[model samples]
Target: MSPAEQAGTQPELTYEQARDELLTVVQRLESGGVPLDESLRLWERGEELAAACQRWLDGARARVEAARRARTPDEAD
Candidate 1:
């Protein structure tokens, strides 16, 4: 399957899953065994995975912040 199709199939991967895949991509690129063209493709996929992971983390942070605010006593009380 195409990289984009594979990425879409894994919609909503947890932060850890996305991170692990990104790390693997980095390792592959660093190994230098791949052709330049394929390496570029991997780099692109890595970028997409990194963005997905960041989005997951951002959402989690927002939720945590919301929860914390909900529990805090009102200063105006």
Candidate 2:
């Protein structure tokens, strides 16, 4: 299944939603109680979530840069 489908019963999440869940994943990993396999799984998920967050941030940055460029010509006058 796609990442949007989630691995199991979990629902699809937006960038912000994935980020929130990633914080939980980080907290669990830091607490150090889960099994090895589970820890690895969380780590993998965290990587994906981090990538997703980066994509969102990159897209936002691109939009802002475009907006600035669009305004630059006007500002020059």
Candidate 3:
């Protein structure tokens, strides 16, 4: 079994890694040389990577918002 499977969680990908891989997937799909089956698989993987990137961005945004709310009015100036 994979380490993540053993750990009972999927491996965590950094936002940059997911975004870079999503770019590669997009490039491959755009290049138009892959077979239909491979293209479909790549498209699915792209979706997964995009979701991961979005989750990372959303978490970061939430943290920033929380920090802003926590700051005193004087600190905001």
> What C-alpha lDDT do the candidate models reach, one value each?
0.81, 0.80, 0.82
Stretches off by above 4 angstroms in model 2 are: 1-12, 74-77
- Using TM-score, rank the candidates from best to worst: 3, 1, 2
Candidate 1 per-residue lDDT, tens place, 1-77, comes to: 33334456555666787899999999999988899999999999998898887777767788899999999998998
The weakest ten consecutive residues by lDDT in model 3 span: 1-10
Candidate 2 deviation (Cα RMSD): 5.5
Cα displacement (angstroms), candidate 3, residue 59, comes to: 0.1
Q: List clash counts for every candidate, in order.
A: 0, 0, 0
- Tens digits of per-residue lDDT, candidate 3, 1-77, equal 33234436578577888899999999999999899999999999998888778777777898899898877476646
Give one digit per residue, the lDDT tens place, for model 2 in 1-77: 43444345355467789899999999999999899999999999999788767766776788899999987877556
After aligning candidate 1 to the native by TM-score, how far in Å is the CA of 72 from where it should be? 0.3
lDDT score of residue 22 within candidate 3: 98
Top candidate when judged by TM-score against the true structure = 3
Residue pairs clashing, model 3 = none
**CA lDDT, candidate 2, residue 64:** 100
